[model samples]
Target: MNWVRGDSLGHGTFATVNIVVPANGSTFFPSPAAVKSSLSHNAGLLENEKEILSRLGSSPHIINCLGHDHTIENGVEFYNVFLEQAAGGSLADQVKKHGGSLPESFVRRCTRSIVEGLRHIHEHGFVHCDVKLQNVLVFDNGKVKIADFGLAKEKGEKHGKCECRGTPLFMSPESVNDNEYEPPADIWALGCAVVEMATGKPAWDIRDGSSIWSLLVRIGVGEELPKIPEDLSEEGKDFLGKCFVKDPTKRWSAEMLLKHPFIKVDSISFDKVHEPLSPPSPSTHFDFPHWASTVTASLPSSPYSDEWPGWSCTPESRLRRLVTDKRPENWSELDGWMRVR
Candidate 1:
């Protein structure tokens, strides 16, 4: 597929993301899709991400990887992977836009989507080593999808001695101490993400000038768990309780959480109670400045061409249509609640 790279969306330590337009006007690919590129010598992680997404197949709750290719620019070789663009930006951007905390209903909706994505990843025998708000991309329709699988690994994949992946702020207890990365670790990180969404703060109280060592010790060396948001609903708190369990064996799996009361609530009505003050606006244009990358880097603003064709149907809309068409005869057991089976 021939494409031209556009504006710099964001850059992490290993990869740079930019909006790319399909030069051939291929209907097979989304126009202005995101392309993550890295120097050829440093493309292993990008290649792994593409392979992982390919293995996982297409899911509405997971970012779609269209394809990958090599390109040369300025006498340098680069590897690039095309991904579905989430115009609403990352969940972190939403939190920041809302002044730190998100409405509980919105948090519930996003959490449900993340869990669904994690369920798919875990059932396929893979672990998302880094599950955080920054890694969850929000769509214009308010649906969320799990993104950034660069740190993902096969279930039970072993790490080298004293090695650990993922940001320290979101690491599971076992991962911090024993170098273990598994499905349970993802759940733990999900708990942290929930806390961030509900409270607009890191799960741990890392005051100014705190060292990473201290944070690791707090997570792995003690019985302390991240504080749950007091303002969160009872079901929400209980749901997080299941995630914050220190014992991986006892932690709730994604399937189990899907049955939890927190996720089973009537999102349509519940959403009305605490509607977002500033819901993300639907747009076909790319808005990349607010999308935070895995690593922090100062980025320059660039304009995207408006002449590109729009998608016939977005992934979120397609998924909604599919659910409406294939919904079980008895999917809802009560008003405002969905049955899990």
Candidate 2:
């Protein structure tokens, strides 16, 4: 693809992201895109990410890959992949701007979008081993998508017994212990991400301390789980409880979590086709706050069946309502999560 490289977007461990524009002035993308590229000598990770994005195809909740090409500067070849620009930046940046914690309603909506993306990834038989707030990109329209799949792998794939692939703060019990993981592990990380989104802090107390060993021991060996924010709604707490299960086998799957009440609250009227929100002005960049409850309150309730997945907590109350009706016989007693068959 012919493009003119622009300013640096951000720097990663193996790649430098930059803004890129089409050289021919064709309207391929309405706005400039972010290109992630690295020297050919260190292209393995970037190439793997490009291949994974290609395989995933077009997904509403996953970052879009415009295309890829290569360039040679100073006799060194560099591989570049163009991605849809997220003008609003990352969830981490947003969280920081919001003074470290986003509102519960915004967290619910953002988490719902990420869950949709995870469902797509798992359905395609891939596991996004790194599912954290930093990797979630946001658009001006208040939409979020999952990005950065360099460490992703196929389901059931094995890794070096001692090798760990994601941020320690969001690592799953299995990953901290055996270096073995799957899609369920991503859900565990998702739980941690939700806590960070809700509380503006890491899920564990050791995050600010200098004890990686203590943190790993607490995650892998101890029966302790990350603390859920008390300020969250009942559905939000219950949702994290499902994702934070000690046993990967019992943890909620992305597909199942999509059915949980927290996400369902966001799904109430989101399926309808709505035009994307206008991009926020680049000059007036904001870090990380979310739309208020009034925006969500304006959405119409969907016409779903009474037996719909996690509808027990529904009265169109926007995720804060209690489960007044008897739970379907299949709900789990341990954490109040709906056990999807």
Candidate 3:
């Protein structure tokens, strides 16, 4: 029973919960009822998570957004979200404990799974602005899932551009620049994930996560991005390089990276190009940081590169002009309106 305890779980910047309640679905009863607290009161705030999750059912690699409720307790209003619980904990927590990144093969598999989740979301017409290891929950089953749709948006909705919705280390160069962003933006974050898994630590998670205003100012002016590790293999470095591009157009598509030698997926038959040298496990070993060892990488040209207007002031950053089947590679073309349930 993972119950929501108002006394402990109900207070956050975007949401307010006085307690946590038991998740009604599972009866194992290890903790309180699970309640996913919202960061905002407007139902629209959680609409993106609602939209993306509604389209995706149960998958081992994706987090489950079960249900939600807008209620009042002691005259205080709050939105209670019922979601799948991950006891093993978030990827960030694990990376911090492990000291630095995972093996290349391990990163490849995990990155593939996360990209799969992003592929599903992008297939529908939504953009997950904030993609990071912290939002990914690793379960005891060795599965990975993307969580936290707090910063997602529809194709062309007119919301403000979020110059910095995610953690600094995991943020894309475009995010730091406050540029007009789109699906590729998530790809950029995915690149950072590659680094995180490769090194076990986010390049800049230690920096200003709280100074939004100052951070935005720095990002828009091209504050130098922290270097990723340098010891990574050519394949590992090349793959992440494509994802870190400042221009959304240049960012590698999930389809493209799936073919990279450094990426591994169990879906491939054992005889594929080359089997993963050895399966990634707790016993994997490395000589040194595989990626960015303090080597600062400059960003590429931006197609829509412009100063970020900030999420609160950006135009058409929402779902207004976006049609279901606008871009062939976009999400609306894959699944229709039924995905929002």
Off by over 4 Å in 2: 26-30, 207-209, 265-341
Candidate 3 residue runs with Cα over 4 Å from true position: 1-11, 16-33, 38-44, 56-58, 161-165, 176-178, 204-226, 266-341
Which ranking of candidates, highest lDDT first?
1, 2, 3
Provide the lDDT at 279 for model 1.
Answer: 33
Over the stretch 1-341, how does candidate 1's per-residue lDDT look in tens digits? 66777666665444667777666555756754888877788677788889999999989899999888888765768898988887767787777777777888788878888999999999999998878877788765667899888778999777565554666678888887787889999999999999988887878876644555677789998799999988999999999999999999999999999889888746423333233433322221123122121221111121121211111212343345334554211211112211111
Model 1, residue 30: C-alpha shift (Å): 1.5
- Specify the highest-lDDT model's number: 1
lDDT (tens digit, per residue) of candidate 3 on 176-245:
5654446787887788677767776554433422343443344455535545678788877877777766
Greater lDDT among 1 and 2 belongs to 1
lDDT of 2 at 230: 91
Q: Pick the candidate with the highest TM-score.
A: 1
Error of 3 at 271 (Å): 18
Between the candidate structures 1 and 2, which one is better when assessed by TM-score?
1
